[model samples]
Target chain A: EAGVAQSPRYKIIEKRQSVAFWCNPISGHATLYWYQQILGQGPKLLIQFQNNGVVDDSQLPKDRFSAERLKGVDSTLKIQPAKLEDSAVYLCASSLASSGRGLMSEQFFGPGTRLTVL
Target chain B: AQSVTQPDIHITVSEGASLELRCNYSYGATPYLFWYVQSPGQGLQLLLKYFSGDTLVQGIKGFEAEFKRSQSSFNLRKPSVHWSDAAEYFCAISSASKIIFGSGTRLSIRP
Candidate 1:
């Protein structure tokens, strides 16, 4: 089966410019997530979507970052007026729906988009 | 708040040597634990997971992790190191419909 797919494996933008990243999750997957991974650090959760509806986005910086999954299949994350601190890899992941036992399924990740803000 | 901690930032061992990476978590209840490996320019891949049942979970690529409740730790181990095993390893905990990841451990194998 095909895994999660992302676009523009690498990106470069100037500070204060806007950037966007795209993600297409695995087929039939019901949950999608966006994460930001700074150098030498683990990926941090930016937002989570369950079938086009947001499940969690508490950690997201609303002032500069936003994400949406319109059809519950693909997602997009945007950052406006980006800062140097925003330079990091943006990762997308997807997982199957929760089971009757309420167990979280394994997450499949994409190659990620490395955004370099100069 | 729930969190995962990887105490080691980087570790190096000779090829064919044993390897271990430490992980600790903070949560109120039992959590689902996982170990993922990320190679350079690649996405994270699940190595193993522990939800219930056996505390010692075996994963792909000959990786294994032991979940210790008393210590609140889930440590990954490999019997022998391989050059291909060089990668960033992350420990994660899932609970209350949320998942948290550790800072990650970088593994390097010496020839």
Candidate 2:
């Protein structure tokens, strides 16, 4: 099976600028996620979508960050007024089920978009 | 709330030697645990996961993790180290839906 696909493998933008990342999950996947990973740190969940419905976005910086999964297939994440702290790799992953124990269902990740805020 | 902890930030071992990486988690209910390996300039790949039954689970790349509920630990082990094994390993814990990961442990293989 094909893995998740992401575009713009790398992006460099000035602080306070806007940046957008796109992701296409595996076919027939019902769950999608956007995570931010800084150097030497674990990936942090920013938003989660379950079939076009948001399951969680508590950690998302609503003031500057937003994400949407339309029709439950493709998703886009936007970061407005990017800050130095936002300079990290944005990874997109998709899974078959919401239950973590969905062992048969692994979250396939994309190459990720490395954003540098200078 | 569930959280994962990797005590070792970095570890170095010679090639052909045994390896072990520590991971501890805290969750109120039965936790779903996972191990993922991330290479530089690459995405995180699932190595293995444990949900129920067998405490010792085998994953890809000759890696295995044993879940110890009494100690709240799920440590990864590899019998023989390979140069390609050098990468960052993360331990994740989840309950219900949302999952949380640890800071990650960097493994270095020396020739």
lDDT, candidate 1, residue B15?
99
- The TM-scores, one per candidate, come to 0.96, 0.96
Cα deviation in Å at residue A53, candidate 2? 1.5
The per-candidate TM-score of the B chain, in the order shown, comes to: 0.97, 0.97
Question: Residue A37 CA error for candidate 2 (Å)?
Answer: 0.6
Scoring model 2 with DockQ, what do you get? 0.60
- Model 1's C-alpha root-mean-square deviation from the true structure amounts to 1.4
RMSD of each candidate? 1.4, 1.4
Error of 1 at A62 (Å): 0.9
DockQ for each candidate? 0.61, 0.60
Q: Candidate 2, residues A39-104: lDDT per residue as tens digits?
A: 889999899898999988999999999999878999999999999999999999999877644434
Question: Which CAPRI tier for candidate 2?
Answer: medium
lDDT for B102 (candidate 2): 98
Fnat per candidate, as a fraction, reads 0.58, 0.58
* Model 1 steric clash pairs: none
Off by over 4 Å in 2: A100-104
